[model samples]
Target: MQFDRKDKNNAVLLDLYTQLLYPRMVEEKMLILLRQGRIGKWFSGIGQEAIAIGSTLAMEENEYILPMHRNLGVFTARNIPLKRLMAQWQGKLNGFTKGRDRSFHFGTQDYKIIGMISHLGPQMAVADGIALADLISGQEKATLVYTGDGATSEGDFHEAINVAAVWNLPVIFLIENNGYGLSTPTAEQYKCQNLVDRAVGYGIEGVQIDGNNVLEVYDTIAAIAAKIRKDPKPVLVECLTFRMRGHEEASGTKYVPQELMDAWAEKDPVANFEHFLLTENVLNQELIAEIKADFKAGIEYEIEAAFQEEEPIANTIAELEDMYAPFNFKPNALSPDAPSTEVRYLDAITDALKIGMYKHDNLVLMGQDIAEYGGAFKITEGFTTLFGKARVRNTPICESAIVGAALGLSINGYKSVVEMQFADFVTCGFNQIVNNLAKTHYRWGEKADVVIRMPTGAGTGAGPFHSQSNEAWFTKTPGLKIVYPAFPQDAKGLLLAAIDDPNPVLFFEHKYLYRSLTGQVPQGEYQLEIGKANVLKEGRQLCIITYGLGVHWALAYMDEHPELSINLVDLRSLQPWDKNAVSNAVKQTGRVLILHEDTLSTGFGAELAAWIGEHCFSDLDAPVMRCASSDTAIPMNKVLEEDFLAKSRLAATIEKLLAY
Candidate 1:
């Protein structure tokens, strides 16, 4: 290839070559490390460098890029140092994640890059959130999220794009259809000729291009980015490229056909782009050789220095410290002379949200039918009319996308309180809550100040799907605060506390008590300690530790049997339970009974029993007993529901404990 002195895009081509060279060198260094047994595995974006560099080059500053494992070229395009990545691969203290992570699974707020999870589709929803935040703030920016053909099959992909299209968010979804998803070929994966065809169903513009052509990919992205920045909307770009290596270094490609691999090898993105540069006289033979040699030497030097960096030791105290983001807010005490109004449990929660939104302009409310319909339980009636649609968002039926989007909003200076419609539906969004929302702070010290409001418990015969107390599910997961308040005052106070906290919080509201429970709520703002238990009544014979609807049942049983002397302790928070209060009550009574609305087997009550037995065994006169609903799913029949969480059954258990 000969050079022409007067080329128009010479500087652009040279810059692309410089950025593209970094990732290729990174892959080469990683391959050497993999062979040397220093790295466990390597997911190389060897032939797909053009798609990474081209797409990223089109993005402007402050725009977000959610990168997957195979999109390492984005790092090079963003000008991240090669040594930092090398140290991360080596699991050294100097790594970006400080040895917490070793793969492409990391992100920093400074770079506007979100670290991807092993599950590929969730980041798309997160990108929608990032774009939505900018759109709401009237900022001119877009979010670029990358995925592969395999991720297209995930429900999150559909849910994410659907929300982006409906809301008209400024997000560009780039899918690299790399012929094969690990071992399954595209022929076996989808029936459509092109993945872009699915965009019609989503009502969004879709474009297809030869991902191997760097200029084509770059031009497409640059054009779309310009249009979307002026008038925000989602656009899907399908880049038809092929992975030239196995899914990982150790995973051999026996399933890939030899002829297919050879055909794709002929159209290598890196080689083709370099030849294009030469034919256009953008670079001479000597200059190309020098550029490659310089990149190689630089990578080699970084790798050598990274090997000597000390690896971080696993420390329990450090792990505990990062479990929750620092939250310090000593709320003003409830004014004694302040006017009070009798409000139901549901209205109390609504009042708390209204107060939270009024205090913090960045507070956002999101859920299905929440904005217009005021939620299924009518907890947010008139919210949309008061706060406007921008703050009170009515989301689609996608649970995962709703929560995932809330995480994005949290990072972008918004406090999102997402309602799950029903607690049972939370399982649909479990991955985002457990893996993304629950672990975000622990992994990168980023506070995901998102509150998940769950309408929990059973009494209206809503059956297994609509009625279930699932607080124990989140209590088992770290990096989350669980609050289940039984009274109206506690519900309002705890919800305010949850919103104020600087970490992810799970706020459970018992559907049974929404209307039935009423109390005098303070008119002014106030917050309660999240992990403390309230002692409603004091006695001497036995101590009943309960929460949510269980408190009502325990109180009713005590009223029915006056001879049974007991103290009622309401555990408002499940995760950071009031251990001191529980211990003191058990010591005074010499007998303990734990109660909850969740199923009996492995319930939160079991944890309380274990703690009491282990910590206060000698202080107790009898073994700790637990009373809860049966392990079976909540039945629709009235008789079955009664027997499931029966007060009579609880009374029987209490009698035994008192007799002990």
Candidate 2:
């Protein structure tokens, strides 16, 4: 195994040996600390250091690498100050996530490292996004993303790889097949003979390498990276390695047989590489001792510094501070005196998207059938010809991957607007939207400037799947803005505002209002304040608070009953709803009615009613009333739907509230 001194890769072998040794020593120290109750937990990459070190170092400096919890070598190889990383593990204020998260759950843009969330397979799709950004920007950069053998079974893994292969994206899907995922063995995870063999179905090149061999990993990944940068297609590399320790320090390795552990210990990456360096005369016993001593001292110094740092305290005000990035809404952009034209609600959204594309060069649109087919509702018709296929991408029916990719794009200085063919389908991508996109900024200060276009609400008898008002689901999740506009003008203006805001937004477009609703929209591009509500009419008897279809229902009910002097308020944004406007209107009217298209139980109206009851209880002449549909699945029959809708009983509820 000894290499000749004349060998050109001699220096590289020495560097690799050092990189592999660093994480091994760091993990050993952390495990000792764990046993002493100093640190909380640690996911040891004791035996699999070669995969993280080799794969990360193989990529170019500007390229991105999405590392998993066990990829400690990736962080250390990039030379991220060990003190900062130690502070992160200690839950100190100076950590990458500011103590919002612990371990390798945080990412840093400065190092081109996107960290992994607990959900394993989503980052694979996110890597596609980073690679897509590089390709769109005409940069020859590739993205390297890691996953385990068991996680390869996740739907997101397949979706991500398939999309990257179809689009010829420059992504390296690195799988560390460590034989087990926690306690579940690979035999129980998938039926495939070899994990790398799955690449054939994807029509991509697949390579199987002995992950314990640092030299092999480095050489194979370096070659693949070079090939991908030139050709720009995905390649799957399965690194056959073993987990020498438990999933976490606390989790024992009782399930692993002793013979298997003994077999893997012989192939220890750090020891094996060290032996080779020693045998090659590149390192003597003294030099090896010196390197270990130096690294140990450095780690101890960093850990001490981290211990002296301040721990983050949980404060209500501080908790809400970084939930969203600063967004300035310019009301003057409305241009009320500009030329205007009548357009449908759907057309207004299309116009706003067109304006956004023209305005922001880095803005990208992704969804199923969004490019040539113009999306499920023809909202993006002619967009492909106007904007090109790169920006307006037609993704596979993989909601999770698409949403994850949007977050990845946002991480790399791009704004993304994702279209869900139907709002109900967002359930497939729920984890990405709620966990990844919603928590990115709060956890790591990375703004997910993503807008998910949800064509929601029921009226057209599209059945239970297609016709559900699901805004209430996302309304409960913090760090997300929910905008549901009723009129065409509001839809256009609100959409533009959502695009401009540096936060994840759920833009719910009422499917029923697509062609049925029409209004005069200003010709010039404009942005409206998302958190601001509009007073459609001012009255003194009772206040009707609503948004989306409820706004139209209230207006129609008011038209039918001219005697009811209603103070109608349209709460366009649900997350940061116009609380002041709602309070003011409730005080003015003395009686308030909350209306929505969602089911009665746990609908967004319930929240409004609770808030009004809490804040404006004294102003109310009567108890707060909520008018909503019964708690039942949306029926397919139009007749049944009409009876099921809240609109059928809106007038009666209004009468009851006003009479109170």
Candidate 3:
């Protein structure tokens, strides 16, 4: 392709010329700093500046951009202030994340740019979520997601793209296929001639373009953006380019051949664009010199000035703060004269969902077999028919994608209550939960108001895969609230409370208690206090501190032995469990027994016991004791399953605590 300054939109092309120059200049500056030991490390997109700048130009101010480390160029083109970027590189308090993170992994929500995680491809699902938010709201905006050729190999790439295609979401997936994913070449990554060809499997429009050509990239993205804005469907655009430098400053380019390097260097996007502009006489070389000089001066000043700023403080107390969003909500109080119905725990959950959906117009439910099939437990039996499939969705058998998409969806003013089919399967989405959902609020003041309904606890002879009490996995996570209900009323009320809370909540509905427990629940909408515990029975001999199915087990033990008066306390919320309630019970009984269905080692019971020992040491008449399942997989046999966490075991533990 040939370029004539008079035939082209010179103004737009000239602007792109300057935008491309910023990243190139920053890359050069960073490489020098890396060598000088001023910066820790650097990941440069030196050769492929055109893809970053050109695609950014095509996006509107309102559209969202999820940028990877290499796409720092996108930030520069969006005018994100070189000073902040420099300060971030230096770990200064003035930087994004307040120097909590050091690189392109930080972004301001106001900028509509989501920072990337070190783990690639998950953000694709997140971006789809952001786009889905707009589609559901009937907004006229598109989402532009950036990924590298290497990320295309990730499952998230397919999971996200498939959802976007099926929903006809307004999103443009821009892949920077720079010939190499780290050190592995394209031939080894996939057999496909081009990355865009793979998009056909997802049933979306796919296009391949010369990533080195600034005008071609800019024009291609501009058209893709326009098409998605109207028809609201996803498009995949693969930019064929190369990385001139190593993967990062540490990864030297010894694996890259000099011959290939020289060939790519000859067609460098920044250099080639400059030559094209100069040859076409686009306002002469003098103006270009001024623009370069101005950018260089500004970059130099920011780098120097940022160094003089205060180093980010390392305060453990402050860091721990803001881990969870404020748990505050005006519960829709149940009417005094409202009717009560004796409902099963499963029906109570469904009732909560129906009521929540009726109350909040933006509530969405997604999980495998949740819509038409009514979930694996039939908890959502008639949800699709009642609330319609759009609100109650059946997603693919991708746990990570479901959670990732829900995280994205929550960012756009919608509340998502996702089901994990089985609680054991939540491990598949652990990365998204721990890294993305748990840290999102702490890293940036963004809340993913998502509720993951986990059918947890072990009792059924469903073996290791189906039976698991994994509540302990998320108890250590900062930004997540965990609710484990033992009865029908608490199940329904706590779920409603979780759905209303503005942070991610892991609602654990004990599968064992789903049908076994039946109690009269309030007819109208009502939410029990989330972080508070409930004392089902009062006693003076011992305090049984437990929750979920453990509460029922404690009650059964009480029925068996009326001789030992025990105070059964349900710590409904694990993360912010009721310390005050536990303290009061311990003070009265002077003997504490912490029990749960999870394994003994590093379980939630351990935390509870530690807390009691720390805060209620003098109040305890004896050492804090706990009875939990052994640190092994839940057994498939009925005899072993009962022995693992049976009422008999808890009864013996209570008797021992009493004697002590």
**Index of the highest-TM-score prediction:** 2
- Clash count in backbone of candidate 3: 0
Predicted structure 1, TM vs. truth: 0.97
Error of 1 at 494 (Å): 0.8
Per-model TM against the reference: 0.97, 0.98, 0.96
Which window of ten consecutive residues has the lowest lDDT sum in model 3? 1-10
Per-model root-mean-square deviation over C-alphas: 1.9, 1.4, 1.9
Off by over 4 Å in 3: 1-7, 331-338
Best by the lDDT measure: 2
User: Model 1 over residues 226-321: C-alpha lDDT tens digits?
Assistant: 999999999999998988889986777888889989999988887777887777778889998899898888888987887888888989999887
Off-target runs (Cα >4 Å) in candidate 2 are 1-9, 333-336
Pairwise TM-score winner, candidates 1 and 2: 2
lDDT of each: 0.88, 0.91, 0.86
Clashing pairs in 2: none
| Candidate 2 per-residue C-alpha lDDT over 1-660 given as tens digits, one digit per residue, 9 for 90 to 100 | 222323446677778888989989989999899889998888988999989998888888788999999999999999898899999988899999988898999999999999999999999989988889988998888899999998998999999999999889999999999999999999999998999999999999999999988878888888899988989999999999999999987788999999999999998888878887877778889988998999999999988888999988789887897889888777746454788899999999999999999999999999999999999899999999999999999998899999999988998889999999999999999999999999999999899999999999999999899999999899989899999999898899989999999999999999999999889999868878898999999999999999989998999888988887889999998988999999999989999999999999999999999999998899999999999997999999999999999999998887788677
What is the lDDT for 260 in model 3?
Answer: 91
543-648 per-residue lDDT for model 3 (tens digits): 9999988888888778878887889899899977898999999999999999888989999999999988999999989899999998788889999888876454
